[model samples]
Target: MAGTLHFHPNNLFAPCITNLFWFKLHHHVMVQFKKYVESFPVKPLFIVFTVLFFITPSAIASVQISRTQILMGDVPVTLVVKTAKKHTIKVTRAMEETFLLGKKLSDSLSEFSSASDISRINRSPSHVWISLKEPLSLFLLEKSVKASNLTEGAFDITFSSSNKHTSWADLAIDKHHQRVMKKAAGLKLGVSGIAKGLIVELMSHHLTKKGFDRNLVNAGGDVYASGTWIVGIRNPFSPEQKPLTKIKVKNKSVSTSGLYQRGSHIIDPHTHQALGKKEAPLWASVTTIGNEGPMTDALTTGFFLLPFHKIESIVQQNTGFKVILITLKKQVIKISH
Candidate 1:
């Protein structure tokens, strides 16, 4: 029997076949095959057919994630999550809870805040008990102290006389008892270096648990990514200049340190003074990326204190870490694996 074929622009199968005989045969077979197709279970078979029909060897779905911002650690933090479809409700709730938890943790650890729990600890040694959900924040403090020691106290966190001679490691954590102990009287613990990074990490973990496989959490300049993300390192000297370098990273962190944003915040711990404003004509901003956001954050400050040659040597000693230094004269230096 003679049969006719019809093509629809919106239909994916319309463009490939040109032979009228094959097209007529296909049309006739499909027209008569309705009962056979309908015999299969509806939902599951429909899904399978839809998937197979769409897999025409060239069709692709470019799924994009959504981003939201929340205030945490005295700064606006942006969280990005990628899923099959929009999940604003879940994202908003997750972010709200994350920020609340972060704020509570920050309140417990901040040394600068007058009413912080750590401040109360500074006043009296009565065994201040602090609870934190973010373990990386505590870990960062320990690592920062060690980094400070390695740099000969260049990055000391105990600069304040009120919190003198303090070590985060000295503050023992009784996980079984859910309490932290500090022996020294005036010793205070602060998570300034790690708080923002910890917030990003925690938020990423939370989103991943919610089925978000690709996402980025950025707290100011500290950024953490679970999948490929784009990051730009600003040029410290050139206010109008574009980023010194752009990087694509996954499951990693990137941080930049310069005299621009928080000028005197990164003080030389040993000198107890501001890092000299003497700008290096060869490089103004130094950005570093590594396994941990807090480490990248701390190392950026440490690298700013060292000379160009020393920066290369230090980066070489540490594998899997990339560094980009931009000088005042617009020179760019990159060290990466």
Candidate 2:
């Protein structure tokens, strides 16, 4: 069995990187072999085979699985995972565990359009103590409030609900009793901004915990890549499905939000209406990279509504965060910290 580790880094500059990588590998191999083999009479054929084994790709032991299912209304939930060699069973079980975990969160967070625990709470009368009975819903609310506060209501979900006088601060959580209650009658919880990304985030964590390292979880374009992955940002209006650009991610999470594809669902938390100009929005696309699901998703949505300066401020304050905004005027702005 070939047990040597192999490295493959695919990206925009693949040829250049590959050449440099291979050169370094060969140099190291030759130098090490010359040093060690000089003390012994080693066959030239033996050195050749040793070097070949290290250079050859060992994908025979790798496994990649992708499955798309109807989840969270009409949105397609896709999970793609690539595992190390000889770990097919490990990858499969990790998939089952992560998807099941994601489904549980999705079912609970499907309240904006579907009936759920959070939805029932939204439908309840004023001051009703909703029994979440699960930590995920509470987590959603916590993240929602945190994002709303961080963005200064720019990423507000409470307003997106067809209710009135609801703010992130009005919601009260009884951590001791494990329940939540709204102060006003019209408050509703919407999780669209953060839910999908969070699912991918949780799935990523689960995969890591299960000892599966190389994987990619794309919850409707919001991605959490455990290892390296080349992700294409699909053009919204292009029927050809061409990627606007490719991004290479390693142990990172990325999200792209736009007035394309599911643009109808992206709502301005303040106006509680779908984003964009109905025909053309001020900004056509937003791409964000980071590690946290809640932050990446919420920030992408929030940045869509924010001015360029505000977006700049955000990137400056947060380390390891980068954003690219493309406007309707064909201007592209990139911010990183």
- Per-candidate clashes come to 5, 1
In Å, residue 80's CA in model 1 sits off its true spot by 1.3
Deviation in Å, model 1, residue 199 alpha carbon: 2.5
State each model's CA lDDT, in order: 0.63, 0.74
Candidate 2, residue 164: Cα displacement in angstroms equals 3.1
List model 1 lDDT by residue over 173-280, tens digit each: 555544455666656554565556655666677666766668787777788888888887776766468876789898988877666765566655445456554432
- Candidate 1: clashing pairs of residues: 282-327, 283-326, 283-327, 284-326, 284-327
Model 2: per-residue Cα lDDT over 1-337, one tens digit each: 2233444342111222235566577667656856786665666777667666665466455668776666656667677777656677767777777778877778877776455667877777778787875677788778788777767787876765456556777788886777888887677777777888887788888888888677777777688888888877766556267777677878888888877655666776666667654534557788889878877888888877888888888789868888888777656677888
Clashing pairs in 2: 61-85
Off by over 4 Å in 1: 1-51, 54-70, 86-88, 112-117, 124-138, 162-190, 238-241, 276-283
Shift of residue 328 alpha carbon in model 2, Å: 0.9
